[model samples]
Target: MDASSQDVARALLGWYDVHARDLPWRARPGCAAPDPYRVWLSEVMLQQTTVAAVKSYFAEFVRRWPSVEALAAADEGEVMAAWAGLGYYARARNLLACAKEVAGRGGTFPADELELRALPGLGAYTAAAVAAIAFGQRAVVVDANVERVVSRLFAVAAPLPGARVAIRRHTDTITPSERAGDFAQAMMDLGATICTPRAPRCLLCPLSASCLARLHAEPEQFPVKAPKKARPQRAGKAFWIERDGAVWLVRRPGKGMLGGMRALPDDGWSARANGNGTPPLMGPWQPGGVVAHGFTHFGLDLHLAVYEGDDWSSLTASEGEWWPLDSIDDAGLPTLFAKAARLALAEAGEVG
Candidate 1:
């Protein structure tokens, strides 16, 4: 590393020693490295999720499955149920696959970056993070926070996706050989707290002297982004079939949107973008309400269709179970289905 880069690393590390965030998965600066299981688990859970949201879940996960072997031994269905409210069902599936792989290898995570990357569901960002934080390796770990910090530090104006290369290069320049773990965590803390995306607290930043964007008086503008394409809107309907104080629920097919989750029967949103517009049973049917939900690629307008008949013929070909209405919370439905359920309940009340 060059002299200037070395100085930047030194300043950041010095600041880190006194100001690292106290998190469940992180060891304090100057402390022994954190457990690799905690680091990997936290990183996976924190993907596209917030620290505040992850804390209770992280604690619960560790409480239940304290080690990689424990998680590996867990039933996939139980894991999926536990991960219900946390959206992005694919992550839960990948988490199980990755845990099993780690446990199969004698319940030890590999310290090498490439080896970590080869694990199931360990993407580039996650692998680098695990290597740097859990194993004290000098890997260029550029997560979203690090991306913003690096772009501003070097005043790189290239828009993201394309700008990622330059950001990685800049981050590598400042990352020190010593205390790689502390350094990585420090950048995450700094970006999250001080050099935030909106209204950065520049005066409190330790690396302000070396920050090119701060020097230019435009820190927020450095990490420029390309304009987002408008998200497509799709329409669908969910069936609310109540029989003898119980509601019909189905376990979604195990490999698509909201896969392996229990939900209200819906026109297969998983199979197609636009729904088939077919109701589960012949009416008399009443409109429960419309529940709006946003997915990664699109938004959905889900119309809830409540059955008004003692129907048995239409559902003979379908597979489902009647869950007690009072205990619906235990069903572990995804957010979209949960919303639809609430709408159905409210409509039922209005009718009564």
Candidate 2:
């Protein structure tokens, strides 16, 4: 590596050795790598999620299913339930699939980046992260934090999605062949703590002397982003049918929005379209209220319709179960459905 690149990696690793965040999945700098299972699981859970939000979930998951084999043997429904409220339901499904794949291969994760990528649902970024953090391989690990750090350090003015290629190249130059795992984690810690997106603490940054954007007095402006498109607005309906102090819930179709989770029956709303299917049974339905939720691509206003009739025969032929009102919280409903259920309960005087 070039002199400047060598200096950059050295300074950052030095800082990381002293100031790395004490995260649940991390090993002490310069120590043996943590369990590959923990590394892989944390990386997956942290995707599109924050550290504060993932800690509890990661702890609970490892507590319940400590290894790839344990997770592989887990029921899909239970796993999905455990993953409730984490959002990105697809990740939970993919997690199960990847676990099964690893279990079939004798429960040992592959050390090579490409082999890890071949596993179900494992992407380039995740594979690289696992390779570096779990196996101490020298892979270019550029997560969002690393992206910001690299963009600012080099002052790359190109907007993201296009700037990523250049960012990765720059990251490669500075990634030391040894201690690459520590180096990668150092970059992440530096970005997250010192070179923040806004009001960066440049004065305290280890590489502030080499930061082009800091020199320009605009550290936050380096990882330039294209303007965001407006998220689409979607409307849908959820039916809440209560009988004998219990509410009727259905397992959503195994492959769609909020798939494989138990939820209040809806009128078949989708990401691409509003709900239009008929309610589960003929209802002299009362307007309970509306519950608003945001997805990655759209915002939804799910209207709630409570069944007012005592129709028992029609629901018998339908596919659903009666869950006790007091135990509704244990049903593992997605956030959207959970919100809908709470609104329905409040409207029915079942909950305040």
Candidate 3:
């Protein structure tokens, strides 16, 4: 490493010794590393999610499945239910798959980045994070927060996706041969707390002396982004077939959008298209209301259709169960379907 890069790493680590965030998955600045299971779980949950949002979920997950072995033994449906409200349903599936793989390998996670990357659902970023933080390996860990920090520190003017290569190269140079885990965490903490995207606390930052963006007085503008394309609008319908204070719910097919989740029967809406399938039972279906939800790529207006007729014959023979209304919350429906359920119940005067 160059003298300047060395200086940056030393100053950042020194500041980190005093100010690291007390996150559940993190070991304190100088302590022994935390359990790999906790570290891996937290890293997966934190993808495209905020720390404040993930804290409760992380706590609940560890409480339910204390170890990687325990998680591997968990039922897929139960895990998926627990993961409700946290979008990105695919992560929950991958979590189970990875856990099972680890369990099959004698319940030990590999310390090498390459092995971690080979696990189901682990992308390049996740592998690097697990290798560095959980196993104390010297890997380049560049998350969104770190991306912002690096871009501002060196004043990289290239737009993201293209700028990532340069950012990773710069991160690799400063990553110390010792305490690499702490250094990685320190970068994340600094970016999250001090070198913020807007209104950065430059004066309080330890590396402010070396920050090129701060010198230019434009920290926020360093991580230049390309323009965002408008999200396409989609519309679909969900059927609320209630009989004797219970509603019909179905398990979605195991390999599509919101797959493996329990949800209200809908008109087959997907990421690529609007719902077009016919209702489960013939109409005399009343229009209850419209529930608006935003996916990563598209926006949906899911129209709730309440069955006004009492038809129990065909539905009983179909692939679903009648979940009691009082216990619907435990069904573990995805956020979109959960919203539809609440709308249906409220429309029927079951909930106030």
Candidate 4:
């Protein structure tokens, strides 16, 4: 690395020694490297999720499954239930798959980024993070935080998704050969605290002396992003089949959106091109209003269709279980379905 790059790393590391965030998954500055399990778990949980949201979940997960092997052996339903309200169901599934793979390999994670990438559900970003933080490997760990920090440091002007390549190259230049973990965490802390998306505290930043965006006095404009297209809107209906103080719940197909989780029956907007908003069985259905939900690619307006049929035999023909109405919260329903359930319950006067 060049002298200027070394100076940047040194300054950031020195600042980190006294000003690092006390995250649950992170080891203290200059301490021994954190456990690979903690690093991997925290990294996965932190993806598209905030540190505040992940703290309780991480603590609960570690409390229940103290080791990777224990998590691998956990029941799929239980895991999905535990992961409810976390927004992304796919991450929970991948977490199980990755844990099982790690457990199968004698409960040890690979130190090499390439080897970690080869494992189930371990993506490029995750592998690099695990290698750098867990194994002290001098790998380029460019998370969203690093992306923002690096983009500002070099005054990258290209819009994101396209600018990622340039950001990675700049990050590589400043990544120190030793103490890669500390450097990675320092960048993350810096971005989360001082180098915020709006009104960054550039004067307080450790690398402000070398920051190109700061020199230009326009750090906020460095990480330029392409305009986002409006998300498509979808319409669907969910069946709220209540009989004898119980609600009918079904397991979604094991491979699509909200897969393997318990939820109310619905027109397949989640896994189809278009939904007709038809009920599962022929019935004089009552409208339970609409529940609007947003996904990564689209937004949904799921209308609730309450089943009026009294014949339990006809309902039994379909594949589902009748869960107690009072204990609906215990079921691992995704946010969309959970909102639908609340609407249905309100319509039924079951909840205030």
Candidate 5:
């Protein structure tokens, strides 16, 4: 490592020693080194999610399943439910498969980055993270934080995709010969707090003296990324049918939009729904309010369709469950479906 980068890393670690946020899974003194399983689970859940939101979910998961053995033994549906509100449904799905795989492999998570990357859904960055944080291996961990930090430190202006490689090369140099986990975590914390996307606290930053962006008095301008285009809204229809206090929810197909998650009855396709927008339900229907949801690729415009009949026994969907409204919170409905369910039930009650 160059003397300048070494000084930067040392300064940043010094700052982290005092300013690092209290997060779960951090190794503590003499308390059975943090479980790699917990570390792996938290990292998967925390991807594309903020630390504040991850805290509660992490606590809930650790409390529910204390170890890899317990998580491996858990039902897929239950794991999905526990991870419901935290978006990225696919991660939840992969989490189950990976847990099971790790358990079957003698309950030992691979310490080598190559072996970790070979696991299901473990990408290069994530593999590097697990290798460094879990086993103290020297590896480059480039998450959004590291990207922003590197972008500003050297003022790399190249667009992403092309820029990521250069940034990765830079990160590889300063990762250090030891304390790999703390260095990676320190970089993440520095990015989140000091080198934030907007209005970075440049003055308080430990590496500010050596930061290129700080030298130019525009640390926020480093690591230039292309602007995002406007998200197009796509339309869909959802059904709302209830009996007693139970609302009907069906398992979305294992492939495609919101795959494998619990959702309301819907027609074959989201838009037009086989034609005329009537979902997979029977009897006369009422129009519930439209519920708006956003996915990674496009926005969803889902119209709630409700059918209320006293002869509830006469109406049945192909495959679904009637979950009590009171207990529906535990059914692992994604945010989008949960919002739709609320609207549908409200409209159903008004018409009934």
Candidate 6:
């Protein structure tokens, strides 16, 4: 947008040309076209998650679904199961909605970053990521990586939530036109690997000479933020029932948390609930250990109770069914319920 911004983008792109990682979403020189679907999927999965953690999830998802239409047609339960352990369960929900929408529109995601932002889960960062990486759009993208890179280069001193606007404004001025994708990746890689929050490798950075934080000898202090508030904890109960070789899993409500995911049948999980309580299910329920799950907003404590009997009772949803608790991996549970299932089976000795 401005002269200085253009300079920053140029330097970052040059550095990226020599140092960028050969990521899956990228097209190799002289190879075929880069898949927009892969770029979109990876950007969606990488929200608030690290690249290291997303690699396997990305590969598995692409392997399983292969296309937007396939993902759209997939059962919400299957998507939830596939997404288990990747954390940010809400992203999974939005992923389904966005995918279905894309399918309904004849399965074509808009190449423009702004239009991409309108999709269910695609935020500013994700939209920029997909647009620049997949469509080579000249969009200024500032993820955690870009934030660190920007903060250090400009020596931004304002506290976060408050500083977001200024940072975005600054970034908007610098994004380059050609090879915009590589420039975006470069800033991210620089922040992630070299311009780290702690003990940045200044001497190794290409822009070290221009880095204000390095000049001031305080790179760690850039991108300041307000102190994080303590997350409150909530308690609930999960009913793990085993009838035979199959373990019992009920479909979670299709609207709320972990909606449409396969889980050990649960009973009313309010923010306030009795820790020592029986779920609204029939059979002899034994007390299993609790399963603790950390969410972005709060921590949840699930008291896993085991029921071993022939009666299904009212616990069965219209579509709820039984599976060998041992076959949970095949059922596709998200991380929360998967952890509960493991705890329940271990405590109830169903796995043995």
Give the higher-TM-score candidate: 4 or 6: 4
Assess candidate 6 and give its lDDT. 0.80
Q: Model 4 clash tally?
A: 0
Instruction: Determine which window of 10 residues in candidate 6 has minimal summed lDDT.
Output: 270-279
TM-score between candidate 1 and the true structure: 0.94
Give the per-residue Cα lDDT of candidate 1 at 346.
85
Cα displacement (angstroms), candidate 5, residue 110, comes to: 1.1
Q: In model 2, what lDDT does residue 327 have?
A: 90
Kindly state the number of residue pairs that clash in model 5: 0
Candidate 1 least-lDDT 10 residues: 310-319
User: Candidate 6, clashing residue pairs?
Assistant: 1-173, 81-332, 84-334, 246-323, 246-324, 247-323, 247-324, 247-325
TM-score of each: 0.94, 0.96, 0.96, 0.95, 0.93, 0.90
Cα-based lDDT at residue 151, candidate 6: 74
* Model 1 pairs in collision: none
Against the reference, the lDDT scores of all candidates come to: 0.88, 0.90, 0.91, 0.87, 0.82, 0.80
lDDT of 6 by residue, 109-212 (tens): 89988899999999889898889988889888988888878877888899887887888887776777888787888888888888888888988898887788
Candidate 5's C-alpha runs over 4 A off are 29-31, 268-276, 310-318, 348-352
Backbone atom clashes (below 3 Å) for every candidate? 0, 0, 0, 0, 0, 8
Off by over 4 Å in 1: 28-32, 270-272, 313-318
Winner of 4 and 5 under TM-score: 4
Give the winner by lDDT: 3
Q: For model 3, how does the per-residue alpha-carbon lDDT over 1-352 read when each residue is reduced to its tens digit?
A: 9999999999999999899899988876557768999999999999999999899999999999999999999999999999999988899999999999999999999999999999998898899989988888999999888899999988988999799999999889888988888898899999899988889998899999999988886898968888888899999999999998889999998887898999999898877798995899885877889999998889999999888886678886458999999999999999999999998888778534
lDDT of 1: 0.88
